[model samples]
Every structure is written in structure tokens, then in C-alpha cells.
Target: MSLGMACALASACCFGIASVLQAVAARAVEAGSASGVDPVLLLRVLRQWRYAAGLALDALGFLLQVTALRSLPLYAVGASLAASLAVTAVVASWLLEARLSTAEWAAVATMCAGLAMIVPASGAQGQHPGPAALRWSLLGLALVVLLIGALAGRFADRPRALLLGLGAGAGLGVVEVAIRLVESLTSSWRGV
Candidate 1:
């Protein structure tokens, strides 16, 4: 396999393993009286060795993902990242002894098959530097997310959780494009 593919797979593996570690750590720590999204609970989880290892793996995964992005197209990288779900399922099955349904196994197979097709067919990364406006728009989105997060407490528990999830998803999407755009911008500035 190519270096990009290797990096992508390694990144996925790191993320998958990290997921299990973090989940285990989260469960190990008992929560306090706060019924909502408790910062203290998060802090407690942070103290766990498993969580620390998970965080380290997450950082490593991100770096490997960036390396993969430098060589592979965004879609290909995305598909490869999706492979993390498959890895997570497998890892969870093994470590957590979580029983997988036949459908779930089938889904994993389908995902793996799709990845097999994607990695081999993917071309080198495209050179287009995205529009300048994207940067400002992303900033705007981030500010909006922050506003939503600040106002989240106003809503009921379910709504607050939903709002936070939406905000997080949007924030992650922003990161997705921003990382590539930043890379493009840097490469352009370097005249590479």
C-alpha cells in the first residue's frame, strides 16, 4: 500500500482504539450531582490514565490524518476516516465483548469493501486553494457555534443536549474544511 494509505489506516486505527479507551475511562469515573453536561465529570475522566492515552492517540491520529491529507484527495481521506467506524466496531467487539448483530457485521463488511475500492482508485491530492471567503465564513460559523453553546443552558435537558451535539457537529465540519484550506493556503504561501 502507498504511504498515504498506510497513514490513513494507521490514523483510523488510533482513533478506533482511542474511542474505546475514552469510553472506558468515562464509565469508570462516577458523576456528581450535576445532571447536565458536567465539566467536573469531564475533568474526572481526564484524570484517568486510559483517557490520557486516548487523548495522546487522538493527537497522533490527527497528525497522521494531516499527513494523509497532504497526499490523498479529501474524499479519499474522508472515506479512509470513515473506516475508523469499522475499526471501532471490531475493537469494541474484542475488548468490550460487545456483541455485533449480523447487520452490523454486514455494515462493517460493506464499509471495508468500499474502502478497498476507494484507496486503490483515489488520485493524488488536488491543488486548488479554496476561495478566500471560506475562511471568514468558517470563523462566522465558529462564532455562531459559540453563541449556541453559551445559550445551551437556556433550553431543557434534551434540547440542550441536541443543541450541543449540533454545535459540535458544525464545529467538526468547520475543522474538516479548515484543515485542508489551511494546508492549501500554506502550500500556496510557500510557492510549492
Candidate 2:
């Protein structure tokens, strides 16, 4: 597998688990709250603890992403973070005692299949920087992702948590693309 693909898969796996952990922590906080209190107020209090934990995780994730970006291309890193939704779904269900609908399960399976299909077989040629086609493709895909995530964010029950996951994914995607462009420019400069 190409370095880019490996980086993306790594991002996906790590970010997925992080999302789930965040969900689990949130559910635990909610469950531990007492009755007859304003949820917003309780949540503000809870943020003290949850945000601290989240910040630590976020720092670790950022470091990993930076290390990955130094070696991988843009698309790989972005796609890996896509697995965050699946991670979130599983984690939320377990922590909140929520049931997963068949549709959600199907979505998770489909995502995995799609990732598998994009990944090259063993010993396949490493990905070359393509023409404008690949760049436009990535741009178009990013736009579509943003639109879908916006729609989902609109109706999300835990909007705060959900938005964090979406934002993190989007941010990671953009960072990867930027890193790839920077790497290309530096490479061309050295060649000149």
C-alpha cells in the first residue's frame, strides 16, 4: 500500500476510536447528572471535566496527524477520518443504551467496503500525483462531504458532540490537502 493510503487508514482508525471515546464520556456525564436541573447548566459544569479530557485527546490526535501528513498525500488522510461516524455510532449506542437501526449498521458496512475498494492491492504502484483531475475530484468530494455533514448536523440530537466530530474530520481533511500541496511545492523547488 502507498504511504498516503496507509496514513489515511491510520487517521481513520485513530479518529474513529476517539469519536467513540468522546461519545462514551459524554453519555457518562449525562447519566451521572441529577434530575430537576437545567441540562445546559449541568452541561456547563460537566464541560470542565469533559473538555479537559477532550483537549488531551485532541492534542494527541493532532500530533499523529502532523506526523502522518509529513509522509502521506491528501486524499488518504481525509478518507480515513470518515470512519469517525461509524465509531461514534457504536460508542454512543453502548454508552447510552441506544439501539442502532439496521440502516446505520448498513451505512457502516458500506463505508468499510468503499474504503477497501479504493485501497490498492499489495505491491501496487505507489500513487503518482495526477493531473488537474485528481485535484478537482478532491475538491468536489470535500464540498459534498461538507454539505452532507451540514445536513446531518442540523438534525443531530447531540449537536455539540456531533459537530465536534464533523469539524474534526473536516479540519483533518483540509490539513492533509494543504500538507500535500506544500510537499509538492517543496519537491519542485528542490528539483529546480
Candidate 3:
């Protein structure tokens, strides 16, 4: 649990820093040169050093997240990941020279307090081999999400952005749950 907590916090920090770096890179691009949905903009952003560094950080965060998921309950890891928003807020304030109102600071504090409450109540990862039906359901959901995301690609900028963001979040959530399911299946197999 302690190790999981450490990994979770590290993951949050990496993700937070990466977000700011990516934002800096994005902001450097020429405004109005391309639409928000333009794939060329991704290529442009990838050429920036900050963007590369952000990608490296994101990779590290992903590894840390996997480690945390293996050792901690989904809820606990989820809470830690959610706290990354607070970390991003702070990083943006410092690095981007963005100002945070008093209310924003209070919200950050509230997020921290909520995380503190969650950690103590979270127990170790469960050993149960979740039903095969659950794994199939997850697989089905992933396929459906992929279809929706593909359809969303045909929309205008704002709607596409919203749908893509929603799809990404759902995909990540599914990955988290799938990790646990995989672990359970593997452990069960080894015992057979």
C-alpha cells in the first residue's frame, strides 16, 4: 500500500508537469494557422522540445500508474489521479504565470483534503478473480467507445474535441479496470 501510494503520487506529479509543458508547447504555435482538429498541428507540436519532454513524462506517468494499480484499489488510484488536476493548477500558476483566484486556491486545498480522506480508507487490492462476464463486458465497451470516437472524428472542432476528450477519459478508466481483471485472471491461471 505504501509503495502504491508513492507510485500514485509520483504519477500525479509527472502528469501535472507534463500537462504544463505540453501547454507551453501548444501556445507557442502560430494562432489561426490551423483549425483545432488539424492533424498537422500535432506534427507541429511534436517538433517542440517541450512537447517531447512532456511525452517522456507521460510515458513515465503511465508506468507509475500501472504499478499503482497493481498494488492499490481502483478507487484509491483514481483519487490520486484526480488530484493531478490540483497539481496542474499549481504548475500552471507557477510556470505559465497564470494567476489563481482565492476560490481556485481553496478548491485546490479541498482536493488535497479529499485525497487525504481517501487514502486511509482505501484497502489493499482485492484477490477475487472477477467474473469472465465482466471482462467480456469491458471488451465490448472498448469496441463501442472506438466506434463512437471514429464517428466523432467527422464532427466540427468543438464537438470533436469534446467527444475525443470524453473518449480518452473513458478509455483510461477502462484500462484501469482491465489491469485489475488481467491480474486476477493471471493469478488464477497460475494457481490452476
Q: Which candidate gets the maximum lDDT versus the true structure?
A: 3
lDDT of 3 at 31: 50
In the range 1-192, model 2's lDDT, one tens digit per residue, is 666566556555556556665555555554443542344754654475554565566566666666656665445445555766676677667755679999999998988887786565323333555467767877776776677566764564677457657765675566566455444556779999
1 or 3: which has the higher TM-score? Answer: 3
How many residue pairs clash in all the candidates, one count each?
0, 2, 0
What is the full ranking by lDDT, best candidate first?
Answer: 3, 1, 2
Lowest-lDDT window of 10 residues in candidate 1? 31-40
- Arranged by TM-score with the best first, the candidates are 3, 1, 2
lDDT of 3 at 131: 98
User: By lDDT, is 1 or 3 better?
Assistant: 3
**Total clashes, candidate 2?**
2
List, residue by residue over 31-139, the lDDT tens digit for candidate 1: 7866736767888899999999999999999999888877788788788888889999999898788999999999999999999899779977767878889888988
Candidate 2 TM-score, C-alpha based: 0.53
Candidate 2 local Cα displacement, residue 179, angstroms: 2.3
Q: For residue 2, what is the lDDT in candidate 3?
A: 89
On TM-score, the leading prediction is: 3
Model 1 ranges off by over 4 Å? 34-36, 183-192
